[model samples]
Target chain A: MINNRVFPWLDERLGLTTIYKTVLDRMVPKVNWWFTLGSATLFLFVMQAVTGIMLSVYYVPSPDKAYDSIEYIMTGVAFGWLIRGIHHWGATLMVITVFIHMLRVFFYAAYKYPREITWTTGVFLFLLTLGMGFTGYLLPWNQKAYWATTVGTSIAGSVPVIGDFILRDLRGGSDLSGVTLARFFSAHIWMLPAAIIALIGVHLYLVIRLGISSIPKENE
Target chain B: MARSGNVTRRGFITSVMAFAGSIMGIVVGLPIIGYLVSPAIGGRKTDSWIPVGKLDTYPVGVPTVFSFTRSKINGWEKTTNSYSVYVLRGANDEVKVLSNVCTHLGCRVSYSKDTDTYACPCHDARFDRNGVVLSGPPPRPLDQYESKNDNGTLSIRVLES
Candidate 1:
């Protein structure tokens, strides 16, 4: 068949058959729906990235115009409401799925022994995900957003010796001015995203490198 | 010995290719990254004087509502925002522009002719014609915009919050 000829041609030039055999033919323990949460989290992350990028195409990050721009997106652009709604809901869903995934890993005690690196990286990933949510919440610059951020950053100022420094660093100044909006906007869209992607790469590499931990049997 | 020599040559070729590939990646990636991040670094909204309307249109001794649209560009995205201001013009050409947003929770305050006061539906806050809080939960007076009357035309300078 033509399929046989094309596959062999590709296999000869690219060693596709060898890669498939090595990666896809590996054995895994029989897992239930709980084991699928990790993949679900990954899918949600991709969805968030795509939707977030679409939103950034029209979102303004300045305090003076952020709310207005959001209004424009909601009323003027076609399907803008749908996209924004999905992004809003998707973020909440991603947080939930990630939390559930972590719980699954912990309850299974998969974080023990040789998988220590994987667990540690996962902890960082969880914190990074929360950071993304916190930063993104302020981009709208509405009343709730402004007040919530004011309170949130003030809490950071309550930490000991370096507290003021942390607050100033987060807000880009002593107060939540336009500079704070700009800072959070950049962190939400750029810095945190880069960190998340890098961490995800390493996490996945570790997972594959160590192979998935099997479920503990009743007698074992 | 022949097999060992062949393996060493393959290893050397692989390392050289890896180095070349990385160099190419940097050369191609830097410009793309710069293009993407330039907006975040350089795009700060500047204060500008936005024209509202002609001075005579605003009635004296009463707060007349005027709505205007301001277009903003953040990076590549452009959006138009509609804003409303209560313009109070005095007999002696004294002009005051008050933001409709409530001081309590940032809700839009509307003029109620029945009560002759500006009221917020969000928290039942009220403000007099001069924008001073009359009742309810407003923490402060309504915000005012810096306005100018130039050749019978009125404009307001919006400041960054």
Candidate 2:
């Protein structure tokens, strides 16, 4: 249903060729399979975002319904299990790939000169990924989630100066309640994701603008 | 062919990073699991104590049935459950509050002045003034509530399971 001329018609104003040259048509030193981890992490993040959005359709943030809604999603909705399964496992895989990608960059000394900001953003992204994991673990409102959160919040309370404040702020009260669940849900679904997206945008732009790092040689 | 379970230095570092990464994940991620269902569900105390009446209003040597209704907002729906407890007042300001439902089959038990026992009509089960089982097919004694008397006012804690 689309005209063949549609692309050029838009490209003339959009400077599609310039973007392609800058982003896709760059030259880089030879590298091995380790370089693929970065792209793999990107792919995993995309998968998680898509699957996570699909899950939010049926997920309820309230305490009473939170656990039951997850059960219903696993059993009641069509292909819901598969979607959640991907989201759950994708979170794990994303963390792995991101870590490996960071190790790769570190070993390659890519963070030395021009890519310091890239590494910084990557580190924050890693922390954000963990943040996503932490916030997401409580969504099911299961026995393990409840006790783990209790112990976890208590551990946070062990901090010296602002420890009590952090624990109370994280829990939203003296005890874990629906208020806490609501707080975590918003951070997991909105705040963390928004920050991750913005950071990813900057990281990718840097990766594109400054090209991938080259492999090192022995005889300097 | 290389040996299985054997890794180079790079592979070794990778595995170490993976392990360390998982530990860091738990340390950071576990705490984010902050707010649980609600503190009211499984908590030390609940605001579910119902005020029955003045302590002196219940006559000594007889169990007085105090009935109350509670409306709770459970998620999306409003559920109201009726609960009743028998307040047994004795000499010297001693008070024993017991759930009026029979322990055997949860059948409502009424105080029978004729027999001087709490009787369940569902079966011929009976409990004496102290709520110990007297006769019939009841398995255990009647359930007792935790009651508190503050300044002549009596209240009982009811945890609906």
lDDT of 1 at B75: 33
Error of 2 at A13 (Å): 1.6
List, residue by residue over B35-131, the lDDT tens digit for candidate 2.
1222224423345777899999999978888898887644334579788788999898889998988988888999988888999999889899899
**RMSD of each predicted structure:** 20.0, 17.6
- Candidate 1 has a TM-score of 0.57
- List the lowest-lDDT window of 10 residues for candidate 2 chain A: A72-81
Worst 10 residues of 2 chain B by lDDT: B31-40
Error of 1 at A170 (Å): 0.4
> Which ranges of candidate 1 are over 4 A from the true structure?
A1-15, A18-24, B1-161
Candidate 1, residues A115-205, lDDT tens digits: the string is 8988998999899999988998888888888988999999999999999999999999999999999999999889998998998888887
Whole-model lDDT per candidate: 0.84, 0.84
